[model samples]
Target chain A: MNTMNNKKFMMIDGLPVAIEGEKNILDVIRKAGIDLPTLCYYSALSTYGACRMCVVEGKHGEIMASCSTPPRSGMEIKTNTPRLQKYRKMVLELMLADHCRDCTTCDKNFDCKLQELAQRFGLKKVRFEPYSIWDKTDNSSLAIFRDPNKCIICGDCVRMCSEIQNVGAIDFAHRGSKMEVTTAFNMPIAETNCVNCGQCAAICPTGAITVKNDLGPLWEDLHDPNVRVVAQIAPAVRVALGDEFDIPRGTNVMGKMVTALRRMGFDEVYDTATGADLTVIEEAREFIDRLENGGKLPLFTSCCPAWFRYAEINHPELYDNISSCKSPIEMLGSVIKERAKQQETGKKPKKTKVVAIAPCTAKKFEIKRDEMQYEGEPTVAHTITTIELANMIREAGLRFEDILPEAVDMPYGIASGAGIIFGVTGGVTEAVIRYVLGSSARDHIADISFTGVRGFDGLKEVKIPYKEQELSIAIVSGLKNAENLIQAIQSGEAHYDFVEVMACEGGCIAGAGQPFVLGRAKPERADGMYEADRLSNVKLSAENPVADALYTGLLAGDKAHHLLHYK
Target chain B: MDNKELYQQIDEIINAQSSEKPIVAILQDIQEVYRYLPREAFDYLSEKLGVSLAKIYSIATFYENFSLSPKGKYVIKICDGTACHVRKSIPILDALRKELGLSGEKNTTDDLMYTVETVSCLGACGLAPVLTVNDKVYPAMTPEKAIELLGELK
Candidate 1:
């Protein structure tokens, strides 16, 4: 066995493959085109060998979990055998006996891993008698819905919330037959400190956890003749929404999406990136004001609703440190409402409804927050996830792929490259830097792309020399990383002028409501956003003519401060 | 106890233990004082211990000893282990339930006088079909004998 790069060559079935310090035999087997079936195995999470489907036999006739078993030098492994297949089939049969098999009505009918595995393993019949362990569906959360009946006790949601997000709002309770993933004291999820991140729903293999469907109310409003329905698409939605229409991941389908919205009866289609453009300018002003007036250092970005809520519930002391600027979607909603009221002359004008298409389920809850209201009514009338938007397009019987590309409506449609990059992890900080330099220090800096803050790293820090002063900034994705950063700041171990925290791993590009793409979708979608930025004529928010017009015309002085800023 | 007194007691229990003491130890102390883990006590402990309420709830529910609901003054433990199962401890449990007027789901009586529950083992297989009323053990228990013991308690 020849060693290459400290990796020992091993024979699997017949072909010789190199195993380079792989912790488990499964990784080596997968590298050699011997894909093993697994249910509870997620690459992003810890290895849980509860499911015995990935069992492979060694030369010594020992059947072991490939996920947990380490590979040996010159080891011969048989991933597929008669006995192993039989065992896998038996496991699926047993799981099916207790599972709620209402596939036609299930939200995850076509997407369910269990159903796919059943067909792959050729499970013709479940011989065991049905033993139902159904529990009442939990719809207490505005963002997420939980159906315990559909849950296979995979512990994916539990692990995702606790291990990744650092929000243990739900955990496994009881043991054996009574075991279930529940909130504190089995209370409703809304009663708990759940930030409504919808990450639990996103990571769930089954339809046990899902984003709450509010399509009914949205459709009703769309059908109403009295309601002037308009749609605003989030920057992240453009990059990932293509996945729903069988398009490739990271494909920017903004034009196609806008056309689809118009076909689905939207009176006018707009871009939330325009709102992001406004945010860049406003937040840059705030940062500059604070820098000059000796205000709070390290102003945290409040764009992510999940991060905002997490701060409120978990770390209330840091509440004042968060930026008062409203998120891009909310900012656009406020702008749209103001524009609608201005357009109307006298008589009670048609109720202008602003429907926001976002890649976040938290936006569903964000729109309903008391602070997001204008004149006793929500600025954003309804919020729907990208997945929900896909369903609406399909329900309207429109061929998304064949539809001609259409441009968004005027006033709230045009956005700069700074606004386009807001979908990615460090894009907010980068955008702010671009805005500051593009407006003031254009002669000093050449390259606008701040590559230091970019990428999928859990936490990234950069110190930039701006106007003869070093400005320290930290960009953090994943709430666990945010928790660590906060702890470091609290312990006086680390300090920064500004911090950007996105609760999701790769910001809104990999949001919970986006179509589930396996294997490194974050960097790919982020690349798409960057590509869009590179192709744009206007690279800075300060250069956007519409933003300049809005600031100079309507959103000026105290009115702008009142509408754009939040507590 | 009053809300203020209960909070103070929880605080006392938590303060008595070292900072590095595990949550289970603190929870056990609170359970002992309240007879069950109170919601208020959990909220207090969450803030004090810097542990999420979800984790605390998980720990409280995982153990068979912990009860979220209040228990009766007297706890009747009937062994349902292999030896006791073959020797017929079910009839004794049924008889005790009938005498105490406690249903299967409602383990504790309305008056809070008695609570009936089944145990996997009592570590005394030699005395099969054993049942315990609080700390006192009744060896070689029968349905009639268990009923008689309950009557004596009243």
Candidate 2:
């Protein structure tokens, strides 16, 4: 594969750039600092090249899409010639003609790629009339909003959902002008087995698909002096929230985040990592019990809501294998609500609402689940994404970057390194491994990190010797990888003692509700999670005092079983 | 249909076409049994076959012959292919629709007696303008002739 003996060079915009092993001409040009406008092309997914904006002129003045074309040894590629400009402009104008341009009030107003491309291409006016039949918005889904009118029909969302996630909840329906990205029978997406992952929403370049922003309702609650609102920040959010404030990606902004939330009327703020510690301990217990007592092998971690739902509906037989423990968010939510009900915090509101901040869209729907609900009301009142928290921070006019560092409130704030690592893929397994092998097993802990169990890969496998048994583990992010692993297990091709499934590829850090990333938020955010873990004084979940107190105190007898475990 | 009975009927069709590779064959068999692809059938097939409902709907909608809604007892298909169009098939289709009180959107009549639809071709191009009633080809038809033919059928 290394054809390095003969060097290849491709001329992009008349500048000769050496191409090592780049797949497409677009990649070569992009590596040479050319930011080509593309709507349907994502490096994570297969090349669609339908947008036609990334067209480059060839040697014979032939136009070819740079995204789909392979880079030749000495290919002449002019990115921005007059003809290319004209074509790109026309493409923009055509897209604009039917684009439902209420740009000032669109969900993706400032963040839209289509809007930026329109501005970049300098589309003054559309030559063609608005020929599209305006469709009504689909607001049926609990987590996602679908406005078909604003869609440029970029297949990024389509590929992300179907190809990347292996959840074909939507696909190309009808033909020509009537064509649309729709669920079966043009039914409401909530009716389908969509899993509510929102990876499609993450990849959607336009506001056609967007995560449901619960900010307005949150604002109403914040304004109401009666309601005591508490916020729990996910470990993933701490690393990524800084992206919105330009405070460098992967920087832990938990302290500043706490200050911002308090300023914005949050009565208490806690870290979900402490809740994650509960999950690791409980899941590990469940796994060990199953291994000992002839229960289902390969106990699936149920921390990921999207993956949990995916298995619940699609592979119902695996229901027994999935861990009974609630996700970190739900576990914390239950504890917070239960505590609020037990201890009367001097009653103006009469009700305490736990508003969890997560780097997930599925978490929105996760809060609404009947199991997540305590009596009739949800344990978590509302689950807001990382971006929504940023919006609130911006609304409060707090200088997030310069805010004085503040600690998270009370007993729930503390979490171990193992818990913090739960933000990224393969982290849940790694954490469980660290828990099973005690904190003192430093050499074994170092060995686990090297044994293919701590990377951002969509699918990872590792085996560790424990007692008499060799505990085999498989960690998968993205539904496609999960689906593949499931098939292998079903076909007797694969066997594992444990499996961790995260619906979003590379886990919560690259979730749909997080900041839109062009490439996979791997090494950057994954490294950040690992770095945060390294800096934590306590390495194992067992070592965390907060978790230990929970195991001994609050979570005792039937109450712990009821609060932490979901039936 | 009730869930059990609906599932029962679809299960029979699936079992019949169990060895069949193409989903189209199963769809065709179901269409034969039910006269149109039921929305419920999509739900059943998608789950059983592991093919997406969106893709099933797409294939259903793509083919002009495949119908999503239930069809009428007397199904009238007027060919509007190149030869048929040149030979004035539109007037014949218009006459049938006008007589049956059917519009573009409303294909089936209120009485459930008639459904008038346009097709690309019947592959009987030598007949110039042609229309079919329940697959019985009527050759060289005019507006008056089409109306007369409908009257005879009624």
Candidate 3:
């Protein structure tokens, strides 16, 4: 909060900088355009000053951890001095001594903070030898793996899970030299109540935790001659995958991704947005029937699989309220598989394998669930993160930027703006509001956007007049925020007609499966989704002619209910 | 004890303690009931206290007083301080372990009758070469005397 009207000033490296409303000295130093290297600092989490790399010199020749120390007015803080520089280097060296030095083969090779800091400081040699406490890596979880040997013990992942998600699947165990992060009783992660959200992997500063290698199975599927590999891209993936390819951040690179997939031997590429439209239509229908026919109120949206699983495990009371809609990728995968197996007019069917490319690690877990399977067969053969898909593109030796853009294949290519905007927080509620309003007109759509269901607010409440009655809606991202809302609802302090929960803050745009993103870069991805929506011809889900054609043709009778929803 | 009994006792302990850090207190009571923290108790306590298994396990492992495995009915504590070591406490510890047929990481007997352990001190430096069975101290204890004491207790 470096404001113009503020009178508070602090000398950062002999330069007077306005303190404004900055609570911590680290943020005050950041106002001066220089950041101290810290492995344990995240803007969204509580101040954990474990990593002493952010230490600054005080006027009285004292040292202070800038992240936890409060910024005082007229304070003289030297951000970088000879003593501080030497101390920082020593800290890095000491942290490196106990850390795993195998960086070249590590998943977080270039992305690792220690590796980056070592290169930044031109560290040629380490005076100390590596002595690791834990040697085994936990590969029991399908979505992510934890390598205890590489853990720097920053406690960022710990805070992110317990404080942010309100899910304490892992915590620091033991003491002193033998301390390690692990599940309760040191059980395998698969045995714990881990929802596989991948936020822990996303927040891990080293290769301590990361998404498991998934390209092996995908490549094997592509190479098998008898297998028909169909790929469906999630709505959030297209906007953020460009972060890996160095195409401008948050740019819509779906076409290039489609081209890359086609070259890598995908039989068909479909947009999961079309499936999101199905969610919008079905979720709205359920909401209206509940509103009119006296059913359970506050129909919770079930688009985010991580949120769905969290609710499934923790809040059994809200089971009836949670919509039975399968996630967009699952919905679309079921349709693709059903169509592939059908003996239709244009049919040369082999064993079909539906691969979902999503910006979610939990989708991997969701695909393997018992309900998502029909008659002992999974709706989706496999789910790969956006990062894994990018790796596949690079492995295929294709120049992504030079490749021509291509459209998703027919039968499910065309989608509504309502579907495309489902990537961001409150985007689903706004989409549902538009459908409930029963309008495709530009004015009505614009009015719905103004109903306070946009932007990156953790929790937003909107009450819209539906017919003669008012429909109350609450949209929240992050499980902690959902926990607060759930508590309020259970205690009878609040009520809403619809509640949408996204486990990750800022929705799928900031999903852990996407490239490493800081808190600031999430809005850019949100903007990309809105921009894509603004450019689409069809503004409403029900108005999309392709969806209308779907209802009349392929999804006639109980087929739509069977394929698009979880029973 | 069965899981239901353990869970009920844990609940009783929790209801009585009602403190901020009740897990440690509840664990102590459960250990008193079964002589060690049972595996099933960790999962039950995790759900009952709304605390993660990691947090409870950390507490259970952090304190040296709590044992994860079952301790024998008659626990043996041999003092190994400088005074006791000079008075030949090693032979007494070895004799007890050998008598119980326990070695290396094994401390408890197969019949669960005796557990042999060495403590740094027993606060009785004057009683050098000391040992304790079930907190009943035996001062200036010799290897033969310890074996004879164990045979009498049995």
Candidate 4:
């Protein structure tokens, strides 16, 4: 990952850099320092090119969206030309006439990109009259709010939901002026396995999506000194927390991260990796038990809360096939409380508070589930996102060196390269092979890398032979992939012995609830995972000390199987 | 409203507008006449010769316009699009309980106003908010619209 080769990057107008194969011209322009105005363009998602604001004058003398247009050699691109400006103005004027321009009371008032662009283009007088008007908001879900009047019909939310989240729960229902993005039949997002990652909101050019921020509650809790608060940081957060502090991406400041958390008023700083270690022990045993006995063959991983919710809503038939394992973040909280009782940190077990600092927005919703909520315990107290954590870090000035890299408590910090890879797509499946199949049989599998399951595609599948057994596996990254996969499974077309489904593209590293990167900077920051995985000393889940310790302690072998395997 | 009066209002609106832009506008009015746009409008448009009837007809077909056949009096158009689907629009539709005993554009009860047609998106997404009674875009349209609009026809 450290090795950089001299690669040819496509030029838009005239910018050059190392490029991936067949990249769009807009990406090339942005990669180079040229900023082009666009209403529908978003990084971390496929471009729709619906809004013509990003129009660039081509060599052919026609204006086109730089986002969707592919770049070629020696092509002349003109951005913000007089002709382009006139065209953008015309489109803006038309949009403004019908748009509800009461920005003061608008939910997205300060954050609306379309409103800012309108002002920039000086679109005060609209040429057209209002066609039809509908000003209303659907506040059905706890996490999502749908303000149709705010939507510019750019299709970013639709595409993000379909392509990135892989949840086709929402789509462009009608065509033309009547086009609206909605869930199947306008149902509340909560009913579906939306996971509420807020990635849709992240990609939205406008404020159509928002996280149901529980900070208000956390603030109230933090003031209560009687409440002993302990916060756990997820593995992926260490890699991206620096981005929140205006630090560059791929900077692994693990030591400074702990210090930052401590300064942020977290009485105790914990690691979600420890919980991830616990997941390995439970999962490995479950795999062995399932293989030996005729339980559910090739059980799917349920680490992703979004994927789990999707299964519960759309693919209820496969619910039994899914491992009922709580996400590593949740598992860590559960384990922390159980262990804290032994340590007796001056508080009763009832009053102990736990918070998870995660890169996923879905973790917010996952913590609220009935299963995650124990009868008496306050379900993981609070979930502060990586973005929020970084903000807290900056709020308190602490050097990265000031905070030494402390081991993630006991029995949980021990994760292998395989466990660390869980932050990426298909990492769970590959990790399972390391423990379940072992290294000797791993060579026979001609394709060690499942290209179909790898990369940023919506859905992928592969068949691998381990010893005499031929295992079929499916890896679904987003909700739309889940929809298509479920439909195929119901139709009896797509068959899989085991499946790994992540709610967001690129897994937890690109989780819906992670830190926000604006403009075209998202894709450029996508390579953070490979670097993190590469730097880890232990690369497999089986090798994690936390997993070994959990097996040796607390879980007396037989009880571990009963508690985790569900046999 | 009597059929003669309805036709008279249609004529008045048509005659009042300039002959230039009203070509498409007049056809739109005829569409409101028999629950669906009529074939006579297409023929008249062809004779108008300014714009081809085929082009006008193509526009009509492209949109959620009515068919050549007669329709019920209370034309009930349901939006079966995606947003409404997630909202469980089907069961709300099922609450229609019994079909209006209608076929094509017309129904058996002769209330002809109650013809059921499924539409795409009607803009009012926040309202999700489906539309009924042709262009009367209802915001936050519930199954209650089915009962309310149907009662108006009766």
**Best model per DockQ:** 1
Tens digit of lDDT per residue, candidate 2, span B9-100?
87887887647547888888888777788788888888888887777887787766788888887898999999999999999888888888
Predicted model with the maximum TM-score:
1
Ranking by TM-score: 1, 2, 3, 4
List the DockQ of the predictions in order.
0.82, 0.69, 0.61, 0.03
Error of 2 at A70 (Å): 2.6
Instruction: Please report how far candidate 2 places residue B136 from its true position, in Å.
Output: 4.5
Task: Write the number of the candidate with greater lDDT, choosing between 3 and 4.
Answer: 3
Angstrom error at residue A10, model 3: 3.1
State residue A485's C-alpha deviation in candidate 3, in Å. Answer: 1.7
What would the TM-score be for candidate 2 when compared with the true structure?
A: 0.94
In model 2 chain A, where is the ten-residue run with the lowest total lDDT?
A1-10
In the order shown, the chain A TM-scores of the predictions are: 0.97, 0.97, 0.97, 0.78
TM-score of each: 0.95, 0.94, 0.92, 0.67
lDDT of 4 by residue, A291-382 (tens): 66877854778888777766775567787788867677767776666566666754344366888888777777777766776446545878
**RMSD in Å for all candidates:** 2.2, 2.6, 3.0, 14.1
Interface RMSD in Å per candidate, to 1 decimal? 0.7, 1.1, 1.2, 13.1
Give the CAPRI rating of model 4: incorrect
Q: Model 3 over residues A1-567: C-alpha lDDT tens digits? A: 333466777888888898778879998888788967889999899888998989999999899899999988778889888999889898888888888888889999878888998888777778997766556789999889999888877888888988889888988877777878888777789888888889999989899999877888889999988788999998899999988878888899989999999999999999999989988999999899999999998899998988988998899888899998888888888888777767434554468899999989998888899989955888898899999988888889998888899999998998899999898999999888888888644568777888899988889999999889988999999999999999999899999989999999999998989998857678789889988999999888888887898789778999999888886
Expressed as tens digits, the lDDT of each residue in B1-154 for candidate 4 is 3555555655675676686656556766666655666555554444443443334444554455635556666555666688876676665455553545544333324545555666776655566646566556555666777667667756
Residue lDDT tens for model 1, A71-91: 888888788888888989998
Residue A313 accuracy (lDDT) in model 1: 90
Number of clashes recorded per candidate: 0, 1, 2, 47
